[model samples]
Target: MQTISSCVEAIVLEQPFLEEALSKGIINYSALADVLQDDVSQTLGKPVKAGAIMMALRRYKDRLTVSKPYYGLNALLEQLGDITLRSNLSDFTFRNSNTLIDSQAAILNTIKNKSHIFYTFTRGILESNIIISSSEKEAVLESFKNENCIALKENLSAISLVLPKHNTKVAGLYYQILKRLAWQNVSLYEVISTTNEFTIVVEDTFVDSAFSIIKNLNKN
Candidate 1:
């Protein structure tokens, strides 16, 4: 027995992307109400009028906008620390298997002495994408050869942005950062996120522009 008010609140809270759209004033309320009425009716196992849903949405808009935590780009920019750019890097991907275990160890050992840039172990069901980096292409190739790798891509680069620890409860912090980059048509290769830090990997060509774009997020 969910009322229209409760249903609207639930929808807004549950969907971050939708909430973002609403916050940015990009959503058509009447169209959204029509869409949500059906979803609400399905969830409640009862009929809901689109007009009623629209009224509820209008009533809740101000409260929801105010209650939701807004992490402004300017504030986030203040938390941004040093930016590191690396070039002459390479990426290696291997199919996931128990046999690749030894190859993983060998790859780690090879980079132990060399000055490498970035490494990520992304595991998947069908296959695994292991991306590692080094200044020397030969060093990367020599280390993982007998390991049955699927692909080796060279001349890749990475830019690491140091970020301060953010409160987990806050919403839209990462999205805000990503939105700026997306708007500028900067393609992200990989994103590494930890509790206290976030890193984005992109091609060497986009490094300066990306850095400038992110750095400007702090501007008034």
Candidate 2:
């Protein structure tokens, strides 16, 4: 754990831009000290002493605040701001060949298989991967099996619960959860959101642990 002062110095060192803000008295030094301690303590998983906090304050006194308080914006943004929510909780499901429906129908149906395609709809038109304009469900179904078109198979080993937006509050929530996973040495392959959902593909082995973590998060 960082002392109150060490945390301040760390913040200043991490974000050099904050120095100018401090000189102009835009930030209250005491408040800045308190916020850093509170935030970092949670991250470091231990109580931060005030003396170390004061040391950090003096160390970065010259470059304390440039525009605003510099806590851990980079760390939080790196983890949280990238998430996109394409589909809601209802949109995710597993599919199997026995019950594979047209891409459009699959949007509402949950099938179980290793391979599946996810489709997004806009104004009754399938704008994303389902590309062709179909007059009816049968036509839409035919488009998927069309020999002229190249079909991409999506494989899901593990599911990622994407948040709708990447606001400060939501970012904080993900950062905390992701940090725990990182500590356990989990690797994540993330797909950035062009649509609504932020997707993270993890190995099948970690699904149970990941789900447990999420379930615990929900309880809190």
Please, what is the whole-model Cα lDDT of each candidate in the order they appear? 0.71, 0.45
Candidate 2's TM-score reads 0.33
TM-score of each prediction: 0.72, 0.33
Candidate 2 local lDDT, 130-188, one digit each (tens): 32112123444443442223232232233445444543433244455665566577666
Q: What tens-digit string does per-residue lDDT give for candidate 1 at 1-220? A: 6777897889887876677677667889899998898888987788988888878877777776686555454466677777777666666777677766676677678767765446666666756665666554565566556665787766666666677665354566677778778878899877777776677777777877788877776664
Scored by Cα lDDT, where does model 2 land? 0.45
The TM-score of candidate 1 is 0.72
Give me the candidate number with maximum TM-score: 1
57, model 2: CA deviation in Å?
8.4
> What RMSD does model 1 have?
3.8
